[model samples]
Target: MSGSQMGGAGWEKLRADIQKSQFVLVGEDHGIAQIPLFTAAVAREFKPAIFVAEVDPYVAQAVAQLVAQPGPATAYLRRYPEALCFFDWSEEFELVRTLRAQQVQLLGLDQVFITTSAPFYAQLAGLVKGKVAKSYFQRQANKYQAQNQAFEKAGNDDFAMAKQPQSAIDSLGLLTQQEGPAAQKMAHDYALSYTIYQKQAHQLRVNLMKQNLVQALLPYQTATGPAAPKMLFKFGSNHLARGLSQSVKGEFYDIGNVVQNLADIQGQKSLHLYIIGKQGERAESDNPNFPAKRVGTYTVAENPELLPFLSQVAGPAWSAFDLRPLRRALTTSKLQLANPSLERTILG
Candidate 1:
């Protein structure tokens, strides 16, 4: 995993933390190629029993099964186009393959991606026994085909699931009300995701994520069983902050906060790490309809607070800064910053 961009010092620090912590969360910028390699390395060192990611639960199940098969990644994608999320990126696919190859369990606890609607509708149509319900699902799938086309041309979320008419949502709810447990759960989560997106309800979304996390851990928490399973989480930076997450207008407790608190309750430790490129290219878009194209560049130097870390980054290779020293200094009142904003960003 030398290509991971992490230097020797970074790996040493990471190994030490992984040894001490029951939970490790890696908060990252989404599109970098090196982050996946770095993540794969961390998975090797941590050997987590569960790896939580930022995709839907159903998508996670499909990915786990897909990588275990003996075939090219593209073949699985071609067979179930638009059925998977982040794995469409080759780097991301390799990361999942590495984790699954190590026999690690994966749990996805984020809202369904934008590409999820049509294939999901098609699957539901195939599963439902009622002719009326099947027809409704089929029609919805066809409608999404048109919506996707228009979305591509417009490059807007006007066709997002959150914008679906209320009557259509009510109809969908009615059809799945009496289905089996799996179908009902999918339908319920699907609708709730839509509501969360429409309202921009960060707290509600994090609540659902926490609920999923708890549900995933329940089996490992039995009184007669061994200690709670070791876990590693990968998500966008904002979702994994140790305290109240930073946002445009407000702050809220996120999954990182929950994981840290969970570790505390279990009489163990959790390590939170944030990673980003000092200056490099990032994917132009997250649109799953097409192959990811890297079209833009970003520099962390734009933010003065990030400059301290970016200045230490050498060349194109990955560098890691141990924030523990800075955190400790702040706690002891040995470090003081004239910029209140910088202090908040670092302390958080």
Candidate 2:
């Protein structure tokens, strides 16, 4: 544990730890711009082969395209404000750009991708062979296009499509089967992720997401097997933990479990970091109009209880505390802050 101003010592240790590892799970308060700014800084420092995010694969692709497009970011915002609206955080625009600019391959670990990017599934209708499967996706594509129009016309309530049917799922399987090798790429691509979304509708969401992570990361494995492609997985802490979560209401195996397994294979280290906002004037965090560049930071007298525990952190309001030492010594360091507002508790 150290002060937020531990300076070079903090980053030296943090980067050293990251260098000795295969996957880093960075848990953050949802919609906090500060976290993403810190994340961009981490990515700049670590330069991992892949940056895994708790984002839709389609949205990631869209942002990449927008970045490469001849127009400004606002063009993207106007056409697909839903992407930013989904997270309700404008600052993520920087994270997307940072990762893309760094040439770090972006992988969206979430399995659910439906409705929001219908054009993807719709276009898949043209790519896949076979009449029956093609017809099924074609119909779905048209329906999704109509839904998009209606959503825009009705002021984009932000919810466009839902409830993929068994028939649609079955048809998608057949479509992928018909497409063969091409379908494999499509299945993992923006369009086919919806099929995954539909499939994971009932399963523990993190399970499929971990599976997706495994598939994307397998290529980075080396012959020596001690080191694989380094990765940073950022998501809500709930989605990164393992074992049974009574709150989530099921037996859950998340990214933490996935990384542990990866460590077992590569013989590397893995960590499960839980972030909590402690002792600050916490307001509602997910503001669409908040600074798009970074989460705003303000000064506060560091609390005595926290001062002794947290190491140097980057964000203005929150500091990065190395909890690994504490995890080894204490069985639990329950971080539910005493001040409720500072916690930035979110419900999804």
Candidate 3:
């Protein structure tokens, strides 16, 4: 596989190509911190028109609005931590701050809420009125209370139904036949489907998320914008990869595939950049002054083969290493990433 280090003239080559892309999906290992630092640099250089996030669209939109209005970023985020829980204090926060500083647009595409959906559902329930819808809402409210009571009596923590309410909108047709206002039925149906099937449900949510993302980015796909609608999708590896996911069932259409298909249909270009962590449990370096050692962050766990090359990676970050020279140094070398397919998947 042909690869280039991120610095020197190498970064210039990657930047030239990346800046031309209409849609760019960058994969991440979620819990890692250094990944965001690399991404921040990319965003600064790439200056994509918009950032497509792996968060709830509704909450993401709200946060985007908040970010655009001004005020402290962290304070605003902490005020409504439920918008996208995982993104709260993680490197995502730094990403958000950086993008906001660059005046980049933020669009969240996921439908699932990390915490309880009751708050959002309650708002939807309030928008309509009718016997069926009211009854459905009342019943669900009572059911939630009973469940909490049961857990209290049993000396257990109250469990929440974290599932999305997409089915309720579908159920409106059936509920309306029960002889009530269509508006009420719509609300009632959505509330009823707030149950989880775990794996299948998660798969469905991700598929729907792709649709949401494509729809959200469709307008920006036009020939306008400062530079042909450059967009960056920062998501988990499973959500951004163009390959099968053992985590989800059925035919999974991840965000990357969705964007790729969309770009193809529109005669545009997209790139899937997957970033992987080291393959093993390599301890953080004890050398505090090591230039590559990130402050308060773990070091990339190098695989056995990369162990010899690990010394080449400085403390600042992987973005600093131009892997091209390293690769040329050893023709027999193959990247031993946690995601074994990454090197072949991209640089190949």
Best by TM-score: 1
Question: Which digits, one per residue and each the tens of the lDDT, describe model 3 over residues 192-259?
Answer: 33432334476667656766665665555556532236788888766765554423334555777767
Instruction: Order candidates by TM-score, high to low.
Output: 1, 2, 3
Per-prediction TM-score to the true structure, in the order listed: 0.88, 0.68, 0.61
Which digits, one per residue and each the tens of the lDDT, describe model 1 over residues 1-348? Answer: 367545576678779888888988888888777788888888878889888999988788778877787654675444444447777677887788788888888889987665667767777888777788889998997787667556645554344474577777677789988777766776788888888877888788888998988787777775754357888899987788777674534667789988888877788998888877788787655444433443468887656667776777678666767777787898799998776545555655
lDDT of each: 0.75, 0.57, 0.55
2 or 3, greater by lDDT: 2
Number of the top lDDT candidate: 1
Off by over 4 Å in 2: 1-16, 70-89, 130-139, 152-158, 163-177, 184-203, 222-226, 242-249, 278-317, 331-348
Give Cα distance to truth, residue 173, candidate 2, Å: 4.5
What local lDDT does model 1 show for residue 279? Answer: 83
Query: By the lDDT metric, which is better: model 1 or model 2?
Result: 1
Q: Candidate 1 vs candidate 2: which has greater TM-score?
A: 1
Reference-based lDDT, residue 11, model 3: 62
